[model samples]
Target: MMHVLYWSGRAGSLAPLCLLIECGVPHETVQVDTSRHAHKTADYLRDVHPLGTVPALRLPDGQVILESGAMVLHLAELAPSLAPAAGSADRAMFLNWVAYGAGSLYPAYQRVYHTDHIVPDEAARPAAREAAVVALDRCWDVVEAALEAGRPGLFGDRPGAADVYLAMLALWHPAPERLAAACPKVRAMKDAVWALPSMRQALAVHGLETA
Candidate 1:
């Protein structure tokens, strides 16, 4: 059984949780309360991860893994149902979807969200906000086009790790009201993504899903 040690929030590890669900593999999700500095505690780190990050997965043999992207890639390889066939069209699509999230979408979201976390000082927030908006707009456009392309799923006809990653990333973005209105494609893409059960669960965990 795979054991995923994670925080309740979606944060960076949200994709892994969704992938675990998609895999339908026997596993357990341990909610690590970050507010209490649980993730930063030495005991938690020593037991599961050297770095103070949640989503440190423990394999049955006792190897621990970190970083959501690498973790999901590994999980995909383990659970073929959630990945794609080697050298097939599905595989190419799957890999592209995965790359877009971690390479493009995720970095863009971080560029925006990091402004809040990294620039806590009130004085520096304005310039940071400008750069964030520019980055966010560009990211949204990229996703917007992909969804408009009419792919049945991120990897064609089925959801995979990449689709999960994109959905989780969208939750962090929140599809800003005006932005969504201006870009129907973005909202459509988000709607299509959140329509899945696994994505919904991740959103609920992240406090992004509404009634």
Candidate 2:
């Protein structure tokens, strides 16, 4: 069994939680609410994550894994049907898109959601938001181009950890309608993933509606 620290409404935490649900792994969740400053507490920071972030997973062996990307990847490995097997031809491409979601798109979203943290100055917040919007849109453009280059989903027909992660990120976009209109393939991918019974169940667990 795994224990995860997360806040249900947050995008950063959703990816791993969905993965665990899809994998049918038994796990417990510890809610860390930013509104209550639970994540910033000294004990939580010291004992769970030094960076005070959510979506940190404590494995059965007591090793804590930080970052949703790493958590989902690790969970996928535990249930190979959730992802491609190691050394498979699709593995490299799978890893690449997953890394892109974590490394590129997620940070842009953080900037959009927490502009104050990026620039503490009150007057500069708007500028930060504008920059975040631009950055996020650019990230989506890259993703749209990638999907257009080949088949649906990051690794073709199968929905891997990367596809799940990307779909969750898309849910966080400020204008979901605009996102769907601009990124048809990403929208298709999201719908396809959500069509899975496991994904629908996962969304139910999170109090979200199916796509």
lDDT winner = 2
TM-score per prediction, in order, is 0.80, 0.88
Task: State residue 138's C-alpha deviation in candidate 1, in Å.
Answer: 0.5
Q: By TM-score, how accurate is candidate 1?
A: 0.80
* Candidate 1, residue 137: lDDT: 75
lDDT of each: 0.70, 0.80
Please give the range of 10 consecutive residues that has the lowest summed lDDT in model 1.
148-157
Q: Which stretches of candidate 1 lie over 4 Å from their true place?
A: 116-122, 149-152, 200-211
- Clash count for candidate 2 is 0
Summarize candidate 1's per-residue lDDT along 97-200 as a digit string, tens digits. 77777788767776676777778787888798778877777776776676644553455455566666665666566446756766565565556656778767
Q: Which stretches of candidate 2 lie over 4 Å from their true place?
A: 1-5, 148-152
Best-fitting candidate, scored by TM-score: 2
Model 2: per-residue Cα lDDT at residue 37: 83
